[model samples]
Target: MDHDIEKAPSAPPTRRDALRVAAGLLAVGAVPLAAHPAAAYPGDIDVCTGGYDAEYEADLAMAEALFEAEEHRAFAPERPPGRYTLPLRRGFRVSARYGIRGDWLAGHHTGIDLAVPTGTPVYAVSAGVVVLARRSGQYGKAVTVRMRDGHYAVFAHLSRIKVRQGARIRAGARIGSSGATGRATGPHLHLEIRARRGYGSDIDPVRYLARRGAPLL
Candidate 1:
């Protein structure tokens, strides 16, 4: 998440040297042939007047402007929203609802836990591209599908993954099998709905899928 600019070597002090030369001219009351309007000020006044190095300042200004432009360009737009289907057919009973329990060390659960036996077939909830298919940390054997609506549907604690990353899958497509792959007491499917774009909100999966015409037990 760290996004910072790398430091670059600074240019030589051409403006400071020029200002010094200009000051010597005005002190001796001798105007140099190279004297410009900026060097016409009396007694090193350019040093204190903030007009000493016009070119140097201009270069610094341009560099700073370009840096800002690059910074903005580095920030990409948020992903667009897309329609999603239920990852499983004939939803199983909800063993644990989202944000209902405080017993977990992570506080409220961000996803719904569907009670299912080990090796139970789990399908893709919607038409989306498989973004994640791996096993790690607490979400063992996880699969993340990014729908066209920019939302992501995650199925965790899977026993096996049937699809690979970057694969386009349709609704109800077999993506994995449910199991107690992560830290859990029994086999179940951990389902999550994450908002697309920069909105990292975790929505209620039951209510969300129900609105999409998917039955929820």
Candidate 2:
């Protein structure tokens, strides 16, 4: 008895076959997670749609979770208090001072500009509550801390803000780093001592800091 078996030719690969292959590769760690191009989706990716890959949908979810974790780190938690210190220690040279300036909108510069290089650590002048820590219009990445004296200490033109609003940071704590993030010609820290919490209430920050024993000279 001679029984010959003729095997059927292999069918062409479908979309599902390709997806399964990708899933298997991902599961076995053959491909790095960073290789997945999953940043396109701002929300959920519909896996119910035909030909959609489940692994890809999962990649998007992982990327979003990572983003949230990083963001949480940026906004630091509340900390204990310490003594007062100047915004800058070494690069304390004042490039601009508070007073009438024709180039300014208020016909005056509301803050003193410290000519520090980009990424210089700017510390808190005194222990206070951070009222504003976000990307302001012309100030760029700014952080305004309401000091114990009720005056606002404004740190503007920063490259990065380390504290969040309502966080009670200590005196001399690193609030942010200096940069030309706002309307500025170069890297500097725009420091303002305000009588009130508004724009037009600025006073001479150098004299103010000196009186408080945290001289910026």
Best-performing candidate as measured by lDDT:
2
Off by over 4 Å in 2: 1-83
lDDT of each: 0.58, 0.61
TM-score of each: 0.58, 0.60
Q: What residue pairs clash in candidate 2, if any at all?
A: none
CA RMSD per model (angstroms): 25.3, 23.3
Supply the TM-score for candidate 2: 0.60
Tens digits of per-residue lDDT for model 1, 40-114: 212211011111223322322233233334332221222333344566664465666676534333235667778
Q: What is the C-alpha local distance difference test score of candidate 1?
A: 0.58
Where does model 1 exceed 4 Å of error? Answer: 1-84, 103-106, 197-200
Position 69, candidate 2: lDDT: 35
Q: What does candidate 2's lDDT look like per residue over 1-217, in tens digits?
A: 1112233455554545545644553454332222222222123221111112233224422332333232232222223323568888674556666663433334466677777788899999988767667775556788878676667788888899999865767788899999887556668888878875434567998788787677777
Report backbone clashes per prediction.
Answer: 10, 0
Instruction: Supply candidate 1's per-residue lDDT for 174.
Output: 95
